[model samples]
Every structure is written in structure tokens, then in C-alpha cells.
Target: MSLSGKEGGCDCGAVRFRIEAEPVVVNCCHCRQCQRQTGTAFAVNILVKPDAITVLQGDPAPHEHPTPSGAGQTNFRCSDCGTSVWSIYHAAGDGLRFVRAGALDDPHAVTPQVHIHTTDKVDWVAIPDDMPSYEGFYPGREIPAIMGEDNAKRFARAVGRG
Candidate 1:
């Protein structure tokens, strides 16, 4: 699916943004931290290059949260509604942003390409049998197989790995 030009915002419509390019990958993370932070079973994130996202309206506030790696992640959220819009993980540096999928105008416009941190997933939440799932983080070297050559290259270049 071409996510280019896709638009989304915070719950209160305070922060609006657009996706200028297709996403590198989509992930449904079931980590305990994600569950606690989102107050849900999981978090569906759209992984894209930082340049791909263009904020069109109100500025979202950045809040840092601790990560297992201890480097932490910063979540940009709507100040008015306190809705998380996107996040920058320290490990990934500033190259990428993980946009909250549920914040999109049409949440269904994209689908999870992979499931991660499944070891901590809620028992009631069932991932499709055919879906690519992992007990922890997805292997970075294998991203090309899942994202295809072009996107894998894009991702690599974005993270300074290419």
C-alpha cells in the first residue's frame, strides 16, 4: 500500500501531520512497556524515515520514556489531549519515527507487517498464524527479506547502516 500523502493527527485534532513517503515497515509490538504506556494490549507502529513525516499543525510535546536498552525513547504527543503521535527510539537515533498507527485518520490504511516482543504479549491477543512474529526484536539483518530491496536499502540508509 502506498502510504505516501497519508494524513493523521492527535485525538483532539491539535496536532496534524502527513506521511510524505511509504513506510519502511509496520510493527505490532506486544512488549510489556508498550502495553503499560499505551494502556492497551499492544502498540501498532508505522516505521518510516524522519523526513517522511511532515507536521501540519500544532506542535506535539516530547516525553522521554525508559526502554529496556536504557537509552530510552521519546514520544511526541498532543499536549492538549496527551495522545501519543509518534516516537523516536534511542537505538534507532533520529533516523526513524514510529508513528502510532491508531492515530491515523484511517487506521486500516496500513496493516502490521510483523509482530514483535511476542514473549510478553497478552494471552488473549492472538496473532495470525501466518504473520511474521518474534519473541523479541526483529533481526535487523533480515529486514531486507521482509521489506524488499528498495525499502531495506532505504531503512539501512536512514539508520546509517547502508
Candidate 2:
């Protein structure tokens, strides 16, 4: 399903955005960093092409932080509300954006297809049996199986993996 027109914003509505293409993948990251950043059990991020997303309104502040790979990532948050809107991971490269799914107008618009960094997950957290869960980050090549052939091809091309 193409999510070409999906829109979202920060909590205070100071920032708004639109997604011009279908998401490449959806991830539920249970890493400690993710938990700390989200202040929750996990962080739900929707991966999409960089140019596919458009900021319709407001300015977002960027905060850089270190990732598990020792590489850093930058989170774009609302200037007013401090809600994380998206992130750019050094590993994911310049072509990808990890959008905060909860920032979408409909938080449930996208559902996570995979769970990553489960090795650091909280003991009380429960993962659905049907969804794939990895103890650590999964191989990038596995996108095809998780997001379908079309999305995988697009994602690969976007990330220079194709």
C-alpha cells in the first residue's frame, strides 16, 4: 500500500509533515537507547526515503546521539513541543529517515513488522508471536522479506544497497 499522502505532526502541532511514498520498513526497536529516548518500552520507527518526506510546517531541532554501532544519529524534534519527529542514522545513510510513527496523525497508520535489539528489551515487555524479533539489528538485506519485493527494491535503491 502506497502511503504517498500520509501526514503527521508534533504534539503541539507546531510541526507538520507529509510522506510522499510508502514506508520502506517499520521497526520496533527495543534497544536501551531507544527506550531512553522514547521513555517507553520501545521506539517505533517507520523507514522511508529521505526525499519522500516533506515538512509542511514549523521548524524542528536536531539532537545528535550515539548509536549502538558507535556511529551517531540525529533526531529531529519539534522546536516547541520536543516531540521527536524523525531520525537520520549514519548507518542508514543520507537516503533514509526513521520517522516517529507516533507523531503521525494516526499513530496506528503504520504497524511495525519487525522488532530489533531485543537483547536489551525490558523483562516485562511482550512481543507478538507472529512478528519477527531479532536479538540485535537485522541484516539490511532482509528488507525484501520484511517489506515485500517492491518496497525492498525501492529501499535498496534509496540506501545505495541496490
Off by over 4 Å in 2: none
Q: In order, what lDDT does every prediction score?
A: 0.91, 0.87
Backbone clash numbers for all candidates listed: 0, 0
lDDT of 1 by residue, 38-87 (tens): 88999999999888999999999999999999989999999999999999
lDDT of 2 by residue, 1-162 (tens): 445798999999999999998788889999998889888999999898888889999988999999868779999999888999999988767889999888888776777899999999999989999998899887766767887999888877877878
TM-score of 1: 0.96
